[model samples]
Target: MTLVPYQGDALAHTRTWTTLHDEELRRRAVKAAGEKDTATLVSLTLAYLTQKGGSGVLTSPRTVEAYALGTRQFVEYAAANAVNLLRPGRHDAQHYINHMLAAGRKPAGVQLKVAAASCLYRALRWAGATDVDPFRDASVPKDRTPGIVKRPPYSEDDLQDVLEKANTHEKFLLFLIAHAGLRISEALALTWDDLDEQGRRLHVRSGKGRKARVVAMSTSLARAARQYRQQYGPGGPHHLGGRRATPPEHVFRYGSTFTARYHLSKAFQAAGVTFRGFHPGRKYAGTRLIQQIKDFGRVAAHLGHESVDTTRKGYAQLAADDLKGDLAGW
Candidate 1:
């Protein structure tokens, strides 16, 4: 596959690929490497990982994407300054750490930078470099400043106003996201067969990086899905006039009322919800579940979080009474 090219550079850089044989590109990568040693390695490593998957202990797609983006920015800086990346010592890595701090990237961003460099160091070792990995002993600073926090979920009454205003398709999308906790990609990629009416749940056949997960459906959401199916059922040239011409498994379909640039935006507009797209809605529902359901394990599983700790961190909101109880114990 042809990778998209990046603009405004001395080398006219493009994304890294599995077998990119563009002479000028490789020469630019090497030239940038020779000047800004750490930067070049960081860039090349992120590119390699993005193409063939990661090399470090963690294979999570989210982690890989973070490292790729962090390193890409660092390399752009190196290319502009003409620094050689291959010969950098720990001092070079430290310099980068300082630079990120000055740029207000904080610990999480620094962690990604370190991770990108660490991945590159491993690749270089495989390519016959004898130097030590600068990131081996490196760590994110304890005093690192925090980034912007995510917003809390909407309250029940507020959510009702939005839902009440939404049209049929809009309401269906919000129902799936808010009630079911589906990622946007998962909701968009859904097919009809994945839903089992009798079973009362939907299978997220594939998720980020193609991981599979099963999600339960609410009684209300299932009803909405049925209504939408009948309204936009298999018909004309849109599904294409033929025997196998079912409205391809994709759950969301374009509506004449509003060209939904994105499912959530259209839903928000239709529903008259004032806040951001469906994430806050999902957050709201998950938080409500925490208060309404006593079982922690069930809540975590239902939300598809890796652990209960994550569920608490993202969705739990402590009431004044609960906070006072802890203070009383103290």
Candidate 2:
């Protein structure tokens, strides 16, 4: 048998292709190409991402954490049913789906799991592993009953009160999320550099689905943001520089989602207001802004929506005279 040129250079190849440790390389290559062991693939994927973090597409710390968690859950599900992912058959995929449905997991929750599995399979393929991707043919129907319910918008008065009384970071965060309709993660990931004070714009490097967009800033919000910068941002000696919190430099780093949620809840309770979810504030902002601002396209663009139809869908009902004119006609 002819010897391969890199016969003893396996370690070098592994190091070249992946950032995995020496021990990890041995662990990953232990499984044969056609093997269908779910545990091994899941573990290998986790190890691969962990070892090659910042050097691959998996750059975000939160993304790494999320993948780690999602992989653990997938492993637990597979081990309980003795299904291997490396060679997942239709039966294995169906069983996992059934398990998730029976466990009363929300559709969104199951979708996250599906997404994690898909990502892992893609990574495995990229790593030159021979495994069939189960997610390619397995997708939940859109019309199927969702595990989560759509939340309603907040009343104008109640929403305004929440904005009025919210603390520094809370107020700006709420404003950015509500008026700008920003995702919670996007709102949290913002920084001083992302904000354009002179041009009155906020740059979202990567919003949902990794899409980048520049959203216009409201005059009121711009002024508030400037004040926030002067007081808490990376500036003079009072700013605390990088010594604040984990990634303390983030615009919304003053609190976590739980903390922000609690703050909003308390504000609601104090104002005798109730909301189905935090999203209502966003709805309220959009609806009210449309009524006050004639340029629907501008409003849509400022809110980072891809089209004006989406803006109209939520705000059309809040037409200027919808309430007063309808009542008078009655």
Candidate 3:
């Protein structure tokens, strides 16, 4: 709290106390809020949020993108409803949450948007854009779904069929995720130098959380890598639609992750497998490896997880029925 000269009378005797966060920085913030320049607000917020957060050298791009989209949506909503960006009405954030809920957004989706909006407002205050955070009190519905039911992993047969039907590019890409338990982002970031086919290991230089680790490759994954290299490495290419050899440095090249997903989906279609997205393949790897090894710590490390608990929370996709046989004669 600070004192400000009262704006009431021409002959006011004293100043009045105000609760504005930063009076000195409010000038530009007030101006931007008054002008409703949400684009500037969003761009600035994204830069602030994505810059080497936590223990990582860089924030995940997926996180950066989600925050960007969520922030943009909030600002756009504010602009549409004539809500002041800096000084949103006390209930405005809740109102936006209601709007999203009514629009069929999931609770998780709503939470992300609210978090992004709140982050942007805080950043605006830091950047001297605004001193008020309208989203501070806004809340979304809590999820009630059982944790075990979420993100079930794909079956081994499903992976086998996918690889059988996929072309060389798609085949090896799935091999990285399904066999090696690599995230799609990590798989897409792979280079030829990262693979040791004969040694049956893959060096994941850019694992999630910016943690680097070498994954033990399956014999199948190693064999597939060797074949992929021999077919597509510095030679006439028959796989990539005869479009010459893929770049020597890059492993899977389809322009972007989106393009990679498209081809992978096509391969799933050809194999008659359900396209439940890519992470399930990683889940499959974790579940299968844990069942085989019976050690959460080792499997979690192999999966590049920071902890066994993290592995259990996200990748423990096995049902009770699936685990029944393990204790049959114990």
Model number with the top lDDT: 3
What is the per-residue lDDT of model 2 for residues 58-88, given as tens digits with 9 covering 90 to 100?
Answer: 3454565566567667767766766665677
Model 3 regions lying over 4 Å from their true place: 1-29, 50-57, 146-148, 235-247, 321-330
Better of 1 and 2 by TM-score: 1
**Could you give candidate 3's per-residue lDDT for residues 205-256 as a string of tens digits?**
9998878999999998888898888876545364354342336477764436
- Tell me the lDDT of model 2 at 123: 60
lDDT of each: 0.60, 0.62, 0.74
For model 1, residues 1-330, the per-residue Cα lDDT tens digits are 223433333122314422455554455555545555444555556455544453332344456456666666666665675534566555667777777888887666577777766666555544344355766666678642211134577678776777777666777777777888776656766787777656778898656545677888889888877776666545523343334322465555532212333644654566666656556766766776776665557777776667777666665554446556448867
The lowest-lDDT stretch of 10 consecutive residues in candidate 2 is 1-10
**Candidate number that wins on TM-score, 1 or 3:** 3
- Among the numbered candidates, top TM-score falls to 3
Runs off by more than 4 Å, candidate 1: 1-32, 35-43, 50-65, 80-83, 142-150, 208-211, 235-247, 253-261, 269-278, 318-330
Any residue pairs clashing in model 2, and if so which?
A: 36-87, 38-84, 38-85
Ranking by TM-score: 3, 1, 2
lDDT of 1 at 53: 51
Candidate 2's TM-score: 0.66
Please give the lDDT score at residue 135 for candidate 3. Answer: 67
